[model samples]
Target chain A: MNNVVLKCQSLKKTYKKKNRKLVILKDINYEFKSGHVYAIVGKSGAGKTTLINILGLLKKQDSGKIFILNNDVSKINENKASEIRNKNIGFVFQSFYLDPLLTTEENIKLPMLLNNSLDKIKINERVKKLLKEVELEDRETHFPKELSGGEQQRVAIARALANNPDIILADEPTGSLDPENEENILNILKSLAKKGKCIIIVTHSKTVREYADIVLELKKGILEEVSRD
Target chain B: MKNYLILILKRIIRDFKSRLVILLIALILLLGTIVSINEKTTEEMLSKETYSKYHNRLYQLVKKESYETKKKDIKGIPHIITILHEYNIASEYLSSEEFKTPNTDHTIQAYTADNLSLPKIKYGTNFPDKQGFYMVCPINMYPNSNLSSNNINFKITNKDRIDMQQYLNKTIQFQFENVNNMNIKKESIDIKIVGLYEVNKHSLEDNTCYINESAKKYIYDTLNNDLPSYIEKSNPEAAVIIIDDIKNLEEVESELSKIGYRLDPYTIIDPNFLIETKKINKTYSLILSIICVFLLFLILFKDTKNTLKYNKLLKYLGAKDNHLYLTNLIHNILIILLAFILSLILSFIYRGLLNIIIYFRPFLFSKNEIIFSITYLFKIFITIFISTIIISILNNVYIKYKLNKN
Candidate 1:
């Protein structure tokens, strides 16, 4: 698509266990576009998360190219990767990895802090705005444990949105939630998608697949288009 | 930046609180060990400091055991580097008197009051440049003062020095009686008064006189009050040697041994004293080192895991490796600064508490100890800096590697 946010080509990864090579991703290719929800579906250990992490620039691909926002990310140094990630890409893990010691407000402000691009006043203003967007303005003072599952996931979503990144990569975003929390988190992801932001979610849920604009299934270390909704 | 610092600080506060007891105990014990050891070393240094002040750069050559078999010749202090001379025989001022009957000479037969070993002249000039006939009237001192051998000899105090100041540039007749080997002979000499030395220079009632070679003809022994000092009354039985510097003591000793000259216990300065003092400090420092090393490992290992999550979180937030490294550097530096300050405070506290017990035999710090302390503190700071950098780099690399692996 013309609005492509991330594209991967011939990506591969492997590990050695007792001198035997175990390949994870083999010559995988994919394109992620803006203004759509893309769901990656696969069984456990099917390399769905691996593809997502490689796409997120969290891990290196063995022999291929990754381009984020039309620039080749593979040859970029660590500083550039961090810069692109902070400025353009956000992450939401299935565990809703909020800092346990921090309040919801602080959790949401963490990405912005790491990015180090925003001033305190701006970050504070942005944090307030994100809390309102996630409908957690009144819960800003509550720590992660004090929040419900749905509330924690919503906080994570707000954290992802803190830097207003161009893309959101959520790995099994609804994997650990109850049906209600799952539905709530799915709606949030779908809302972000509707707002013309790219949302990449790795999930095993049919409900998540139903809501996605595109679905890709991983098998034997490769991606195949399962459907286009 | 502000937000990042606040977050890092918040994490540190939380972690520190969680491990407050262990951290505090470890820090206090670690710093206390260094400080306690420093305090001990300081005291030891100060104790030797006074004695080392006059002797730090002094190296002496004693008569060889082999020479004692010959016993035919005595080599007294040489005039080339000679500041003062020692006379085994006692002398008496036949007439003039300031303090009273006295003997100030310790086993240290005599020393020339050079600018190095002797204090500034409070009254007259030094003895005459030529060896004809000159005398330096020592201040008559009470015997028990620290300058004399414990309590047996005479000593001159500040007051005696003031009284003796008038005797400067005044001639006095001295009677030297030789009673060696039961042979009795006497010589009377009218010595020119050249100068009066600082009275406090030798508070000991050392009946030592600075005389020229022309006056050496009268170094005879007296009958009544000559304490049985170790110096032989005759010359050629003992020789005085001066070392250029204390650091060269080893070389000088080796050289002197080749010439068959042993270390003279009779000399006030002994290189062995300085060596012994260093050995003591080294022993304590080794103990300190063991404790510090143990603490260093405990701190590093304990902190490695605890900081991993924070490190990962920062990295995830798009912190460059340098930023992370810098942050870790500052964090470790803060801890080290705290520990160092705590060590200094602990040292003073320990000193204050322990100094009372050591007050009786008060030892003052010497120039060498002062210089050593400065160098030692510099070394401590360099160590802290190096350790902080190393720990930060190693820990950051390790955490990054582990996180990447996972």
Candidate 2:
């Protein structure tokens, strides 16, 4: 039996520019399942980021149905979307948007704190494990600015995984890293998938595409299966 | 929940030192408004109390023509009495004449004043009943004794006041005609001596018996010499006036003019205490209000500009729009609440300093206070609400514009 965690069907989005319309996403159908890594590779303006935003419930599709674990959430209100985003979805960004004032461990612990689901003792345990998993246990007390770009990205990844969501959405996760840090980040994403969590990465990097269980190309407002690794 | 409160408190302490200067500006401005409101209210109340307490300094005099015409036509103390009484201005009446009481060769000054505007009693009750129609004799109504100050100094050896207390509840007859000793028909009436009052510097009288207006006709008859006058017995010898307030002096004078008194160019005695105090209180109160509102607005403007940076990062994290909104509402409310508390402390300190100085210069402030009325409470809530909304929107919009620009 196939377990689908997130899927979008016939997704469409449009932007209005003065008197004209610009179509961003059209006739896109995809399914992301458990325990797999899907890499969406595209050029700079290929609607990859827009699709990831739609799938994460941060933005609404103009015309389509999005199913997350059997629930149609294409047109959910902002409050309901916030609840689902906080409880079930985690995001990792290229720029490593950690609060500059908070320490590394505090950054990792922020999602759970906002969610208010786990106790202090449990959150502490989760923070330590995430710190060790991302290879930043020694730097847990350091602030975001004190770390290198790769270390900031690792803290961002750990924050994304803090609430133990079933799926992780990464937008250019390795785009700003050195080759060594990029490889280390990929190994972390791959390890998460192996541990039965679905990972979706939107990137322009060929190394990320090679590491994916499935690779898809987004071009001309459509997504197509390009290869299987 | 507790953790959230702890975080909020930690954020407060962490931010307090850096924000203290602007916070003090906001606090002082807000407190100016509060203390000004108190000062204005208390001053107004104090003025009104002073007006009511010493209103008898005002007097209304009638023209001789108006008095004579009304006496011939209305058969009473002229139409002005009824008119003044109807308008609630003449709360009580005062008339005085020298009269000899019953079978005794003793004369005493007599007047008419109702319970409301009567003289204060030193020993006995003040106008024992609301409609008490009796006489109050001074204790010094006897031979060679001028006990005007209540401590009896008798030029004669017989210092007693003919034992006036023994005559309580006893009838006293008077020849109720005009005192001018004319051949008018005698109209007699019975009066009872009921109470006695003290003599003081500001006391109404020392050697008079006070009665109500029901006895006014008999005293006026005495002016026609032991007989009832054919026309209304001339105008009252004097009328004691009490005004509602110093502010109402113009209205009272106008109303008196309408009742046929010579008020064409009425000379109004300017109430010195009320005028000066009102000027000082009103000027300071208005200045405080203006300074407070301006400083409070500017402080909020500056604070919103400064804090927008931190809030944007929280919004970027998993915080919803409402999350950021609530954070701002709580944050601004907390600051204003602190300012409000400090304002209260500042007002108390002001009162304390005023009290310290009051002993040396007594007229600086009165005992009237600025109590928290429902209206004031409502104003506080409204000011807080409106200010919070402005600060919240300013912070959110400016941050968004700056971020988008970058």
Candidate 3:
């Protein structure tokens, strides 16, 4: 009975397209617990990114409330939300979004820079540790452009775990990666989930869904758990 | 604060190339605005009453025909330091004109100055503290321009250069002549050469001399004492008006003009007229400052897409809008401060270059005084600072609002 790390109740979001109300998410209730990898599978334009963005606090939900560690965060101001995100949640995206100017080591140290609790020595130590976790110790000085697709993705994962957040939300993490790199990234996410971190990934790949502990299907703005055949 | 500074440095390093272009334009605009304001402030300084206390400039006044300007005529003019009468007397031995013509080149021009016009003494002493008929001549005896090899038979070796120093304590006879209606009267007086002056390095070699005001008056009076009753005693050939302030030149000239006196065409005019008057061109300064701010805004706006993309990325990394706002502010301020320092250095370099060019080739460029006031720099800095703050805050807030809307 892993503790539930994140929960959302009756979530709804809508947008106005051509004078018509288009619903992106409708009355969604979900609980994400620790030590599980949840794959949110949806068709293109099915609001998968929207759901993940709201859960990551990168975007605001138009209606309904969210809870992290049993504390309500829906009414938090952006500053507090940012603090919570920095401390409690991590995000990875399809584009990798590594600061082009930063080296692999520096990119891994980015989120830790926001954590005031970590001194310079601790930050450096954590960066080295994370680089080792991703097996990128040798490539620490290489810029994102210099790294392969898989190596860059590993650096992105290392960056997401920089502050040791309990929840990791990834959007199309393997969308641009090859088959071998995709397998490698999924195995890393699986290892993170085994370490008692809640990993939620939004994707369209069936292999990722099969690899996930629980698969959720998002269709027409509704989310439903699908049975593993 | 350290963390914030590090973040700012990171952001600046990443965007350094794109920001370099904006920095250059900002520097140019800043210098342009500074020049405009310097012009306006110079004009304002000219009109200020306190300026007279620290300034003194020279101008010459020549008496017109049928006009007798006495000391009483110029007494009422404000800012007049002193009116010294200038006299041209014939010196037989001291004048380099002797090489050219025994009669014509002997005319030596003399002036009466209290102390401001005294030349730097290179040898011997300056005029006595209790001055009475004292004179100071040039160290180098420059021949008259007409004393070329073709016209003059005078040839002197370096031995002649040694003889000029011997005249430091010697007395030379100066002839004071008055010619009236074909009547000629001549009086000779002995004046001692007390000091030798070091002439300017850039000036052509010339034998010019300085005499105290009392000596000039004594010679003028000796010639005027024998004049007929129809001629006035206090009338001078010309008067050199020493003004206490350059700023008061225009006003003093106007006052002198009102009293039937005109400045000599060769008189040195105040340099402020080069920038024009405040009423005519001060508005240009304000316009330039406005344009500078607007141009900065335009550059920032043109880069908005990339800036917004970076900001969004930082936001996704859990940065608050406030942090992003501060980062933008610090970035702009850093660029502006760099431009400020660079513009200051460039302006001083420009001033030095202008003076150098004007010094060597006087005909090619007019001499100008380019003064940079700290008050004006501070004022412009504040203007840019306020504008930068407002623009940075507005830009960040707008981006935040726009992102929220999306």
Tens digit of per-residue lDDT, candidate 2, span B9-44: 445545654258436744554554454555455545
Ranking by TM-score: 3, 1, 2
- In model 1, the runs with Cα more than 4 Å from the true position are A1-3, A7-42, A60-67, A72-79, A98-159, A174-196, A204-229, B1-49, B52-83, B88-116, B120-252, B267-274, B280-312, B320-345, B356-406
DockQ of each: 0.41, 0.19, 0.41
Prediction 3 global C-alpha lDDT: 0.71
Which residue runs does candidate 3 get wrong by more than 4 Å? Answer: A115-118, A220-222, B13-17, B26-56, B60-70, B88-111, B115-210, B217-238, B255-262, B265-273, B277-291, B341-385
Tens digits of per-residue lDDT for model 1, B1-406: 7666666656555554434633553454444344445544554453443333333333334564432432322233222233223342222333233333344222112233443334345567665555466666555423221343444223244443324555566665554445667886664557676765544322233444445444543343224326442234444344444443345556655655665666553445444655675676666545554555456556765877756776676666667778877887776665655555555555545444444344322233312222224344445445555755776677778877887777
First chain of candidate 3, TM-score = 0.97
Instruction: Work out how many backbone clashes candidate 2 has.
Output: 11
Report lDDT (Cα) of residue A3, candidate 2.
75
**iRMS per model in Å:** 1.7, 2.7, 2.1
Please, what are the lDDT tens digits per residue for candidate 3 over residues A1-229?
3789999998999988999999999988999999999999988999999999899887888999999999999989999888888889988889898888778987877777766678888888999998888899999889898999999999999999999999999999999999999999999999999999999999888778888999998888888999644
| Chain B TM-score list for all models | 0.60, 0.52, 0.58
Range of the 10 consecutive residues with the lowest summed lDDT in candidate 3 chain B: B47-56
lDDT of each: 0.63, 0.63, 0.71
Q: For every candidate structure, what is the RMSD over all alpha carbons to the true structure, in angstroms? A: 8.2, 11.4, 7.6
Which candidate number would show the highest lDDT if scored against the true structure?
Answer: 3
What is candidate 1's fraction of native contacts?
Answer: 0.58
